[model samples]
Target: MDSQTGTHDDNMKPATKKSLRGFAAMDPQRQREIASLGGRAAHQSGHAHEFTSEEARAAGKKRHARAQATGESPRA
Candidate 1:
């Protein structure tokens, strides 16, 4: 039974539930270590995106337009 909702899911086994919650139950340091490994692998595999100046300028313009429409100030 779920403690928060007082209900149970019959389809999921205990091990499955534990595995699903495994990553989030890890410490902050361990989480960052795993994330860093993935980032390094992505860069090494030539899948990381490096934005050009024109692309960055377009993105900034879009953000500024959205902020102006919403009456929120854009960041520098």
Candidate 2:
């Protein structure tokens, strides 16, 4: 019997994939509203990992605060 054709088990466990359970469980209309409000799109689309509107605003606020403390304009 060829080694390649042998029935030996490889014994490797299948990898667990990441899931978007919370977001995906929302109603379709709610999902669409979130999307329209700049929430991340579902799945691993290029835009999926991006910040939502509230997150972006919070980040901007933090950046502005940091810039002010360093005596620099936030625009820069």
Q: Candidate 1, 18: how far from true, in Å?
A: 12
lDDT of 2: 0.79
Q: Which tens-of-lDDT digit does each residue in 27-46 have in candidate 1? A: 98999999999999999999
lDDT for each residue of candidate 2 in 1-76, tens digit (9 for 90 to 100): 2379866556756579877688798889998898876644444456656579999999999999999999999999
Which 10-residue span in candidate 1 carries the lowest summed lDDT?
A: 12-21
Which candidate gets the maximum TM-score versus the true structure?
1
Which regions of candidate 1 deviate over 4 angstroms?
A: 1-20, 72-76
- What local lDDT does model 2 show for residue 23? 76
